[model samples]
Target: MPNGQGGYQPIFILSEGTRRQRGHEAQESNIQAAKTIGEAVRSTLGPRGMDKMLVDSLGDVIITNDGATIMDEMDIEHPAAKMIAEVAKTQEDEVGDGTTTAVVLAAKLLEEAGELLDQSIHPTVIASGYGMAAAKAQEFLNDMAVSISIDDEEQLKQVAKTAMTGKKVEANVPVLAGLAVKAVKQVAEETEEGYEVDLDNISIEKQVGEGVDNTFMVTGIILDKERVHPGMPKSVENAKIALINAAMEVKETESDSEIRVSSPEELQKFLDQEENEFREMVAKIKEIGANVVICQKGIDDMAQHFLSKEGIFAIRRAKKSDMKKLARATGGKIITDIEDMTIDDLGKAGLVEERKISGENMIFVEECENPKAVSVLVRGGTEHIVEEAKRSFEDAVSVVAKSIESGKIVAGGGATEVELSMKISDYADSIGGKEALAVRAFANAVESIARSLAENAGLDTIDTIVELRAKHEEDGAVYGLDAHDGEVKDMMSEGVVEPLLVKTQAVSSGSEAAVMVLRIDDVIASKGNEVGEGGGPEGMPGGMY
Candidate 1:
């Protein structure tokens, strides 16, 4: 037939029909591809799970059970598999651990759901049942939370140690845990009401050169070395200080605006007035016992020379944060502008020192009473190790903050939620209608979490889920699957619930994002703006901080 565009179109030619069938087959191939990738690392679950050795295309090898790290190292091509990867990112971004668990659970759930679909149990029914189960599971999770006292350091240590298990460096767990606790305590002690410590905030950054000793605080970032100026003094002790947010120079006067000839008479007159003003400023600073100046703005050459001659240790271009730290240390007030400086504004300069030892950098600030002045000095043996350590520290900080703020952790990366979805789907089967899709969607959402965890742990996502489901079906073989010794089976079985906090937000958002990607049946080359037209993916939205 002739189409609207005046091009003759094929009207069901057998040969073309066969070619279309092949295209459909290619699309269907993604299903198996996705499932196969998920099935590759199933057995590595639980505390006793084996480690995965990921050999990249470039031949670099990574050995670990951390979910996000493993998935990040893999070269995944399938859209569905990428969806699985997003889940791990969610878990990592939220709970800092349990990503492996989430991925394994999702893969297993999807496998079982697929089987149920084949058995004539529609996707709708299975999904419904999953929703019911998820609700119940949340209840169980809430019941399982061990109410912890903020002052209970032992319990805090337990929490930190639990997060550290199955990480890249097991030997460093104690060190990381201690650092976590110290950071939490430091932050908590500072707030008026002792704010909850989120473990994610306290990150460890390891830099190598000359290692830093544990006792030092620098209010200023160190350059390769101290500033060099002939008039500038090397050191000043017990020096009075003034901190200004503005440039320490006179503003343009009306006389300066008028252009004049290059006459020595006028030039000397300008110089004399400027010199007097400069001397007066210096005299004022000296009267306050101020031998040092810290400015948030740039220093003028004239003022720099005047301060330098007075043996003032002046530092320019200081950050507001550093200024605050310096003020806290020295019991000084930060003047917003030089014009705002009053006679009483002068104070002793904070003692800020830097020391390098054994390839670590440390900053020292003296006479600071605020708890915020205290910062942990984390040491790492290698560059990679230091980076990882720093990441771990940051995770620890956020977790600590959430724990202190909310007084609980969110069911360990939405594991409870997945378990609940299984139950919810089961219940939904008893009812019927559009709600069935909701049930399926929720189940799919939960399964996504499991798959992400498995991928992160470097296990076959499908196999890991299968193993988890098998363990779940077996009752108590897997630690988290079923409770034992008079305890409730899974957190789901115990009436525990996900915390209504950042953890849940990240998991749900990430899972939704992953599911949106998974739902894609075809791949098309589209413009960037058209990529996420339909509300985009879950975690892929505006939620990423």
Candidate 2:
């Protein structure tokens, strides 16, 4: 090290070639990295947004406009960008929609903060101001939210349709929306805290041969397994189903031991004893009067033969999830032991049939009286189409369930974002000084949602924002971007609605991520793995500035 006193001295703090960024440089670099990640997915923000086709290192391709999918598929290396991506993930996991809004909002907030930094404002002031603005934005959201009830099926369908608006299966949204509402409603449970929906109770299965319009909802569970034996009946009417978690095969001893049988007669006796046990197990199931058997584990060959002989429909290797769904749909108990099974343990369904779908045979337990567990079978023209359609359905189903559970909604199409921005800006004027600037920045950041939506729709963003801000200032906050015609319209009258839970989560998570990124003042990176000619610090591709 060179000393200021014109003397040479050796000193070590950071390891040689280790990178360090501190103070203003560190904050600026992190914000830029986060903004880059935000801009990467901002174009995929609304109903008219374009899709991103991300090709991974393995050449696997994902074409989607979903914010969560885009962020997850990208090979992002910057640590700050990864944090911003996590904000989208959190929003997706919590609300199942508004991922793009969350990301774009966070990015815009940092961009605004950077401007404040240039004007000599401190990062702590910006972070603090954002915290207050976030809390107030939540209040505005609650005030604007339209209360609904679980009985409002039409409103719930609108919520699903709104979520599916920008998806690839737009043509099938009406049909898919209906199925999504039905499935979520079937699985919803009433609790002291309003209604709670476990989306897991609603399953989505996809197959590729049919068109998107061919998708349908099953009242009961649809097991991917076919009948265990070809000799078994193809279908059973008035099914009394026995759900077994244990295998039908003869179970071996928990502790292994070698058996020595020198005589051929002794060997035949041992075989006879094992055969008798298998027969007894099947007989017990028959005694229970179960016409259909669903096993979570494998069934022995002899057991299958016996089941077929008794004219009982049997499906082996059923997934635990499917078995649980069966229990709910059929009102049956899952028997753990052969001796423990009884007639009362059997579940009832109108029919249990093995049907061929897309050239694959699958078991369908249909027409359960008031089934609590249901499934949606998604069909499309090709594998990729089916996958994309299924993804769209997942979003629809999740949002519908969320709406039913919360019983509250809001107008979408950037209406809510514009309203929030206006409200927060008014709030900023109430406060004074530099912190107010930060609060105002948060409000402006939120307005980027409307800007991005208009941009994605091929409209002039500046003109759209100017018109939207004027509309909010004069005519209240009902007006928003109408992507279809590139104009501002009332989202409420247009039936473009979303769950309140989605909007609240998006704003809160986005603000939190922005604040986190702004607070970072230091970054220390370890040495890179490879060394090359003319390489910068520790062989990093582009060394830290």
Candidate 3:
């Protein structure tokens, strides 16, 4: 394609309809998209924040103010906006809260970076400054964090309550918070690195009958199923439970075989042998002094009849996961062989009862004095409310778990953000270079969190910021925006606290996302075929700008 002259002629290096955007055009478009995403979730920040009602293409609806939920529900198409949304996801995954704060901070950072770009500052410089500020911001958060322990019930409840402050279940926060702290403490185990909380060990079940206030924690696992046979006991007290993974039925031969039974006597003998096998299995279970049988496999009809005749409460085909949780909750081991069953292998439970709930039968294994696994039953007036309450309870549980694992917490209600802002600005001034501007910009961006809190609460954003800054300067880092009263107060004294890891992770994740988005200077998108090339809408790569 080279011309005869010294230079080469133009060649169609890209596809015929391909389009691209580079340099400032691409950067500005990406920044705008990210900022739009941030604004979408900004109003859903604090206790006074409004919830978003997201409807999918299938007409399924979700109502919540949780940042992660909003991000997940929104069908975002823009790549840059998707990246911003991931900031919230990362925050949610790492600290279990503060997703809104993280995304808002990242959006604000990009907004500030756009202004710097107008002043001839390079994207690299802004990213570098953000990196420095993020590191220092974490340091400030650590310095301000108050030490907590697994035994700090009051503070731990505060953590859970703070996490559930703005959710639909806010009215039941105190009770749910107590349950969250208790559940997390129960499942928490000490590892070599630190205390670890396996959230899976804490199961949350929702039953829509009563109001959210009826939610309570169970010391043992709850099975959604009831007794396998009606003749079995409806309730068992002082129960000796057997955890079985094997089927209480005769095993079929591995190879297919044909049995020729010409006489009725031969058939009767075969039936009698099967009946004896079932009786033997039941005999072994009863011989172990077990009154409650939780099986992971099927129980033959004859076996069920024999167990019911013995007055044992038996539930067959229990989920394997439920079986494991049952083992942990009951301090029992799952036995695979009937011959190995013994009294020593039995688990103790004060009560095992089948209760009728909302016209359905449910099994409750309650009153395990030292059970490791637990369940939280959430009740609400409607299905939607119950679903929302479950989300809120899960958030509370996660936050409490994080607090226990980290053993550090800080004042909430924008207190940590305000303090980090002041500290970061101080560090910016000390740096004294082009990067200092970026660092200062990062500090200003961090203040967006407080502004968002005030804005969501229907307060004057500028006035609230000024007052918060003045108070932080005068009182200390603990002074923060009390959105409830539109006043700057000491968050620590007010019992408004969050896990320190939440704030630190928000800053780090937000900064990383913002920096990554800012560093982009080009966008190349491949458009898929809308229809056949010969008909309908055309398919081609289009420049976002």
Candidate 4:
């Protein structure tokens, strides 16, 4: 250590063997980690991108290239890398698609900032400039956004199809996309702010056995359970459904109690009383005119028998979330107490039935007058295929819902990114300062998505960018790469569409992440208290420092 007085004392701020990185060293380390994470998911960007097969310690495997899923499943140890993952998560949560674009764009922003840092530009300046560029890019996005409505079924289907394009569900994109649109339209409600959707109102259930073509949306709800007893009718028409949060079993004392019975008659009395309570519960349900019961808690064996003898179809131990959806779908009230039940609390459905598929029984409640909540059942030939199809369908549904709610959309297939790049680059010239360099860097980083799309499609990257730029210059800003043919074409006319929220959210999330990483000029990790090796704190980039 050195001081102006030509003398200094060694600082002992951290514990023994603590790992520390400072100044350029720390910034580079963090930036490199961000880049590493970005590149990890880069190849999964477009229709032709590749999928990853991730296996865990227990030998369970996941195969997909969805950016948010990949980042979640990865065993990331770097604190900075986790920050990068948050970018993907935010994109997924906010807009449901374009996670790879957000992540790689964030990484490229950091990589560009690293160059500025080398040339003596302040990190805050770079962050501020990037922020300004991002805001302007959003303006360009909104100005170019096309209005969409719930009735715009064709465009909505295109949005869903674009989302499912590269996820190994291409063969069934048209069918699954229709299901996504229908599901979203069913759950979407018009609000003063726009159409507001509660995706919880839509449930997705996946079963392994049938081909993906069998995937379909249910008019009502699906419970992944069966009848409590086989003696009960397997199907009930004109079903009066009761959604119960309370258990049908006899209530046990909450505390310990002692009962001393000197004779067998006394014990028999206790048993009769318990049996009568079960009979009373079943009788109460019947009195309320509920032919079908869905319980959130366990039903005792005695109670199940009574329910079956009464010709009532009942399911026990249903999930609380499922009960909520059922209430929404059937227009029933979730009764917390059996004693408080009444006919008014019962909901009506055309039919309630139990069906077996893939060697398991499931209950379906359908044909409600107008269900507020709906369900989609995804089926495939195998577990892995079904799981992946479920993911693809979910992404499609999410984007369509967002589009319906926001009432705004943009051309997909990298068209928006290329236009955004050109707009931001021109805006950088007007700022005219050291910050201008950072702004230009922002332009380049935003273009990484288009580049990745081209590269993944096996097109020449240099030629692709050159032609895209020329097209934008020629006032054909909506023209983008058609990955299927390696040609520049109009994305909007080609039926490639995405929700505007996806692009703006990606820009905002990616820039914020890049700024957070850029401003971190130091990293201090405490040492691990091990007997032998140099294992640092829980999140020390796996000892990379």
- Cα lDDT of model 3 by residue, 1-545, tens digit: 66888788886766765546688887887787777778888999999999999888899998899999899888766677778889989988887788998999999999999999999999999999999999888888888989999998998999999999988888889988988998898888889878998887988998999899898888998889989899998999998999999988889988998889999999999999999998888899898899999999999899999999999999999998899889889998899998888888888889999998888788999898788899888999998889989988888888899888888999999988888898999899899779999999999999989889999999999999888888888857888888888988888888899998888888889999999999999776555522112111233111111
lDDT of 2 by residue, 1-545 (tens): 56889888987887777777788877777777767777778888889988888887798878888889888887666677778889889988988888988988888899899999999898999999999999999999999999888788888888899999988999999999989988888898999999999888988898888799999998998878789899999989999999998988877888988889999999999988888987888889888798899998999998898888999898888888888888998999998887988899999999889999978987889999999999889999987789889989999988988888888899888889888988998999999988999999998998888888998999998999888888888965778888999878888888889999998998899999999989988777767622221212334322211
Ranking by TM-score: 4, 2, 3, 1
List runs of model 1 lying over 4 Å from the truth.
1-136, 189-205, 209-243, 248-261, 264-292, 300-302, 319-334, 342-350, 357-363, 409-507, 518-523, 527-545
- What lDDT would each prediction earn against the true structure? 0.52, 0.86, 0.87, 0.89
Question: Which of the two candidates, 1 or 2, achieves a greater TM-score against the reference?
Answer: 2
| Best by the lDDT measure | 4
| TM-score of each model, in listed order | 0.64, 0.94, 0.92, 0.95
Candidate 1 lDDT by residue in tens digits, 423-445: 55665576676546545655565
lDDT of 1: 0.52
**How large is the C-alpha RMSD of every model relative to the true structure?**
8.4, 3.2, 3.8, 3.2
Worst 10 residues of 2 by lDDT: 529-538
C-alpha lDDT (0 to 100) for residue 527 of candidate 4: 70
Q: So what's the TM-score on candidate 4?
A: 0.95
* Better by TM-score, candidate 4 or 3: 4
Which lDDT value does model 2 have at 344? 94
The reply for model 4, stretches above 4 Å from the true place, is 1-11, 529-545
**2 against 3, candidate with superior lDDT:** 3
Alpha-carbon shift of residue 121 in model 4 (angstroms): 1.5
- Tell me the TM-score of model 1: 0.64
